[model samples]
Target: MSLSLVLTLLGAIFLLLLFRYILTPLFLSPLAHIPAAHPTSVFTPLWISYHRRGGSQALPAITRAHSLYGPIIRLGPHELSVRSQSAIHKVYIEKGGFAKPKFWADEFMSYGVRNMVSMQGGIGSKEHAGRKRDLGNVYAKSVLLGSGVLSDVAARVLRGMDEVLERIVGEEDNADAEKTGSGVMEVYNFNGAVNADIASSYIYGTDGRTNFVGDVAKRNEYFEHHGTWLKGKHGHAESQKWLEEFGVQLCGPGVSALRDEEKGGADAVVYKQLHARGLRGNDMASETLDHFIAGAEAPRTTLTYLQWELSRNPTRQARLRTELRTLPLDPTTDIPNLKALDALPFLDAVLMETLRLYTPTPGPQHRITPPEGTTIHGIFIPGSTRISASLAILHHNAEVFPEPGVWRPERWGGGDKERESLEEMRKWFWVFSKGSRGCIGKDFTVIVMKLIVAKMYSKYETEVMEDGNMEQEDKFLAGPVGERLVLRFRAVK
Candidate 1:
């Protein structure tokens, strides 16, 4: 056959298969019994994919579908959304048979490189679990609380805040002759500095640290470079094809350039130190690096939101500051040793409330059912079906959280009813997710948040700058939609 004839035949075959396998099922199959976000959902995955690509709107759209369809909504011929908490636990925690959905693996895994967070399938799961087991002891609460990690992070945060304050004070002094109203100073970059510093320290240890706070220019450059890769647009087609064939090892040129740059820079020094401390090779070093980089973004964004919340509610901020003041304040001191700080009920309440109201990355935890049929939310679901549960929808359920959208930390305290409500919330708190696939760095994240918030409140007064936006983009992870935040800081003696 002529080449042109062969090409024409191939195109015809592709169209036929696309209509038969993709179009008919999405539109006309039995699974179509389930409601779709749009009329075209029955015929195409494009509706959902477009929203997913839109970033933050993805979860809200899924929640809207669940609201209309109830706990189980048929999304595609093979896909379903489970909105109930019971269903979430049943599908994700109890039925150990499901594997991560292909969409996540395709988007997240680096050139077929399977870290625990992005690994899929039975074989991948086993490999990831084994790696996690080896690293579990290091991340335990006792170790996190004891290793002085939080204290060191707190110190770095304080240092960064001091620098901001000094610069503000200097400006105020210099501008005394031109005297403006209130000498405002915006601190747009501190949260990012604190998280990047804290997260890097934990992963690489203090002796082998990167000055995320001190090296603003380099850090910003790294973020811009990495942002392109995260969008999956920098050589995405080539990377995905390579991943499909070779797995994670086939690092695309862009990714390879990044790895090479880091390996030659100060980050490489930290990687070496980690190896010297008996951690070696790609699994430990690579996974730690990926976690540190990805993890820093959300918590920093969360802290910025928390600070904004505190600023808006000055009375609450004052209460937290009062609580913070009662704790010991020696620069050499560790917070865990300060029982008063550790026991601050309102602070804890505020943190929990922030977590619920703004779940970082409120997207669904996607999974594929086992070969054997399973029951979720008491309904039977067949194997090979795609299923997911959204944290945002679950957290906002009015039944569990009264006045769900309001920020009410007091509700976390009151009495038995309040305590019970809080307990239930904790159970359904999919912030760090649940089960074996849960975030391995949960403890580290918590420590970082607590330390940063405590230190900031302890040493300075914060107010929201006019440009700050608490609204987050609901992508795979929630972050400031435009990746921008600004706040004013004034030193308090």
Candidate 2:
């Protein structure tokens, strides 16, 4: 053939390739039927990745996109952001066809091995299920409230809080003069320490307990290292090394802490079950580390906001104290029965309201569509597509939560419609996500949350002194934007 003829044929082939690769994905593909977050999202990831790196702005940005574009929106060439109830139910519940995205392994495998939270591949799911089944009773609502193991841990925490109270009220003689005996206590650190101590207690037993509440400085340093590891600011490996060192500290020399062959703490309780049913060493450590890693930041974020809200409302604080007094725990020393605390109407309202307003992990809970494809809200999402639903978006949904931004505990108490209202709220209450992969520690976390709230508000009246960065952070595991809260505690008369 002549050179001119060859050039003409080449040009025609290039045109065909453009139509197949670009034009089809932009205008003809199944995802093309859905609204695009940005026009380029039809064929590229630039739009979504840009926003993902947009920091805290990412939540409001995606939230606005759903508000403007309806429930299903294409965020990338292969990514779908679904917010509709029908879509959420299909992707996360009824169909349950989507698997966690690939990043979960890298995100959670920091403990030198993968735990159930990071489990992947074929048998990995079964392995996770097996771990949950074997250990499920340990965190069950009935068992947790009744378990001597948790009760002992709670008793320890309550005792620690009592000490913390003394320092907060300037009653302790050896209290760090600079750190305590003042009304202005950094409860951000206090909450974190309490959570860390409890988590460590369960993971490492009473002997290896971390007394963060007792020593605020130690918790400050521990969490500083912990946060560095999470944000990967300096570098992930360096930060992770620090965290792993801390992990070893939590588990070392305490496997037999509750000796006499009467091991009762979680370290012994879970280890025995896991070993008898097959699993040891790193497997044991990974799960324990999962608890440490998963449990720490949640309570920190939660208590800060709950206190912030209460500080803004003095009457609510007084009423909450009245409700807490009904628990019957001695204001100075005694611990309340967990069951009675859970049954408190006002305490339940405060916790449920906080979680709804400030869902801890408000970022995307992502899942990939199955090989056979799936339909969300009547829109057919092709197989192998990346899809997700944001709890932040779901929680603020106007229809489900009227005046979504307002913090009104009364909304949770609807008398005759109380059961009906709570059932409806649960549908929109995506703080912990839903479906098979829902947080196993939801009840566990709630128990701890209610317990602490019950204990703290029972005697102390908190005043928010300096709450500069009160905004919630924009990361996957986020707290207030300020990341700090300074408050004054006055003993309730």
Candidate 3:
């Protein structure tokens, strides 16, 4: 063929490629009807990817997009961010839930194995349901309330609180002070230690639990690795390995015999359930490791922010203490009954408000549309498109939560009054999310956090000594900026 003929063919092919790859996605596709977060989002994921990389400003940018573009907006060429309740139901509940995106596996898988959180697709969903069934009874609200597991967990939390009190009092005594607790304590790390201990004990029983609360050196060593693994800091590979090995050791031979005496030699609930389900060796270990991962950091984040809020408002803190004191203490243990502690209206309000305002895992949970596709909020999202809903965005809806940024526990109405408003707010609440894929550890998290808060505020009034950079970081497991919450816990007279 002549050179001119070849040149003409090449130009034609180039135009066809442009139409297929760029023009179709940007202008001809159904997703083009949705508003783009950035102009580049119409044809590429580059804009949102840049924001999400290294935990950069994704949440803020998405929030702004939702505010400007209504409830549904295009996040990338094939990705969408949804905020309406009806859309959430359609995606998460209507058809047995959408498959999780690859990000869940890439980010959450532990010990080179998939747990429920990291699992994906039809097979993964079946396995997840099976696992949930195996462990459902133990995590049930009634069982958790009645069992020795939570009782032992509560006792352990109190012991941790004792150490905190001692540290504060000891430092003050050394400084020749007369009043109790004039010394500053970094609570974020301590809270992490306390949460880890609680989670391990509950999962493996007291015998396999780490005594991080009593052992500062051990807590520091563990947190150093854990924080490194979580944040992708330098040396993260080694840190990740160290964490996995630590989990493996806890699941070694004969570790299953570790039992709680209070339960009349009942084996550790989770380990027993996993063993009965025929998960042995690394499988069992990896499953337990996932529980540890789930249990530790989020509660720490909750407690840290809860205390920060309480410290900033002394009147509300005082009111919480009064409500806490109303619970009749167990004469022997000197701690309130787990069920009664859970029933405190004011305490529930404060916790609910904190969860609403400063949810730890407030980032988007990415899900993929089914192969056949479906409509979300009247918009027909195409098959296999990436879509997500954020707990942070839903929790901050101004219509549901008036003055959304303010810390007003009363907005929850202490569980009785404002019935209509409270119902509306609850519909928007997604802290633990909803539907079959919801958090399996919801009861565990709430009970442990309540126990810790009940124990702390009952005896001490916290005051912020130095809470610099308390703004919560915008990440999957959001925590306070600066990773420090210094406060002085004054003894309540």
Best lDDT among the predictions, by candidate number? 3
Q: Roughly what TM-score does model 2 have, to 2 decimal places? A: 0.92
Candidates by lDDT, descending order = 3, 2, 1
Q: Candidate 3: where are CA atoms >4 Å away?
A: 121-124, 170-181, 253-263, 415-420
lDDT of 2 by residue, 162-253 (tens): 67676657744444322534756767877877877776776577777788877766777778877776765566577678777776676664
Among these predictions, the greatest TM-score belongs to 3
Clashing pairs for model 3 are none
Candidates in order, TM-scores: namely 0.79, 0.92, 0.94
Q: Which stretches of candidate 2 lie over 4 Å from their true place?
A: 1-6, 9-13, 54-57, 95-97, 121-124, 171-181, 262-268, 330-333, 414-420
Put down candidate 1 lDDT per residue, 1-493, tens digits, no spaces. 9999999999999999998977776655656456676676666677787777734347877888888878788665567888776777767677453688777765665434555677775423666566665565666767656655456555765576556556664565432112332425433344666677666655554534456566667556545545545555566465335323321221122233335555552322233333444543454444555666655676766776787788788888888888777777654643435334545777788887888888876888888887776776555667888888888888888888888898887777722244536677777677878877777777767766776678778777767656445577776667665565455566677
Residue by residue across 332-407, what tens digits does model 3's lDDT show? 6667788898888889999999999999889898889988888877777888898889999999999989889998
Give the per-residue Cα lDDT of candidate 3 at 130.
Answer: 84
lDDT-wise, the better of 1 and 3 is: 3
